[model samples]
Target chain A: MNFFGIPDIYLVILGLLFLSIIMAIIRVIKGPTAPDRIVGLDTINTIVIVSMIIFGLAAGSVIYVDVAIVYAFLSFISTLFIAKYLEGGEF
Target chain B: MLNQLIDIVIYILLAIGVFFNILAGIGLLRFPDVYTRLHAGTKCTTFGSIFLCGSVILYGLRMWILGNVDGSIWVIHTGIALVAILLTNPTGAHALARAAHRSGVKPVGAVIDELENKPTKKSANKMEAKK
Candidate 1:
C-alpha cells in the first residue's frame, strides 16, 4: 500500500483523469455546435491541470505543478480567444 | 498508524473525484444540446478536480511531514494549481455560452427565447431611411 512511506494515492487520481479524457473525446467528436466543442476543450484543460498536479505528486516533481500553473493560464487565454471568435467574428 | 489513516482518506477522495470527473466528460458527450453539454462539462470537471487535487495535496503533506522537504513543496504547489483551475474554468464556460447564443446556436428544444438581444436589421434599415 505504502511505497517509500508515501501511499500510492496519486495513481488512483491519475486513472480518473485518464477516464475523463476518454469520455471528453466523445464530446469533441459528437458536438453539434461550435461552442459545445469549445466547452469540451475547456473542461479538458481544467482536468489536465489537476491531473498534472497529481502526476507531480506521484513522481515527486515540483516542476509538474509549476507546469500545471502555467498551463492553466494558457488554457484560460485560449478559451477566451476562442469565445471571442465564436461571438461575432468582428469586435 | 497516521499514514494509514491518511491513506484511507486519500482513497476515498480519489474514488469520488474519478467518478465525477469522468461523469463530466460523459455528460458532455451524451447530452442533447449546447447548454446541456456546457452544464456537464463545466460542473463535473471542477467538482472532480477539486477532490483530485485535494488527494494530491494530502499526499504531499504526508511527504513533507515525514521530513521530505520536496514532498511538502509538491503538495503546496499542487494546491495553487487547483485554485487556478477553480477560478478560470467557469468563466470560460460562461464566455462560451454567450458566444454560442450570439452565433445562433440554440438549445436542443427550447420553447421560448427570453434573451433575444441580437441587433435586428429592421432597426438599422429604419435608421438608414430616416437619414
Candidate 2:
C-alpha cells in the first residue's frame, strides 16, 4: 500500500515539478539582464535533473537514472562555461 | 505498523521537498534583482533536491530490505546521483554569483560598493604602468 493511498505517487510529484519549471521559464523569458536569464537557466537545469530521476522511478527503468547522472554533469559543465563567458575571462 | 511509519516519513519528506521547490520558483519570478533571485533560486532548489532524492533513497532501501536484488544496485546508483547533485549545485551557484558580480549586476538599492572601489585587472595594470 502506498503512503498517500495514491496508485502512482511519482506522477503527482512530477506534475508539481513541471509547474515549478514553468515558473522558472517565466523568469527566463522576462529576465531584464543577462545574469537574470543565466540564473533562470541554471535553476531549470537543476529541476530538470530531479525530474529525470522521478521519471525513472515512475517508469521503473534504471537507465533513466543513469541518464540523469550524465545530464547533471553536462549541465554543471555548461553552467561553468556560461559563468566564465559572463565574466569575460580568457579561455 | 512499521511499514506504515516508514511510508509516512517518506511522504513527509516528499512534501517538504516539493514545497521548497515551489518556493524557489516563486522567488525567481518575484524577486526584484538578479542577486536576490539567485539567492532564492539556488539555495532553495538545492535544499529541496536533497530531500526529494533522500525520499527516493529511502524507497530504494525499503525495497532492498524486502529482498529485491535489484534494489541494492538501485540504491547505490541513486546515492551516487544524489552525491553528484550535492557536490555540483553549490559550486555552480558560487560560480554564477561571482560571474554576476564581475559582470556588473549590482544588488538593488545598495548603499556601498566595495568591490567597485577596488581596482580591477585593467585599472591595476594602468597603476603599475604609471609607477
Best by TM-score: 2
User: Residue B84 of model 1: what lDDT?
Assistant: 88
- Candidate 1 stretches greater than 4 Å from native: A1-13, B117-131
Instruction: After superposing candidate 2 on the true structure, give the runs of residues whose Cα lies further than 4 Å from its correct spot.
Output: A1-7, B129-131
Candidate 2 lDDT over residue span A1-91, tens digit each? 5744435667788889999999999989999989899999999998998888777776777788899899999999999999989988467
**What does the lDDT come to for candidate 2?**
0.87
User: In model 1, what is the error at residue B69, expressed in angstroms?
Assistant: 3.1
Candidate 2, A37: how far from true, in Å?
0.3
**lDDT of every predicted structure (CA atoms):** 0.81, 0.87
List the candidates' TM-scores in order. 0.86, 0.91
On DockQ, the leading prediction is 2
Candidate 1 lDDT, B14-44, residue by residue in tens: 7898889888877876788888888888888
How far in Å is the alpha carbon of A42 misplaced in model 2? 0.4
| Candidate 2 chain A, run of 10 with poorest lDDT | A1-10
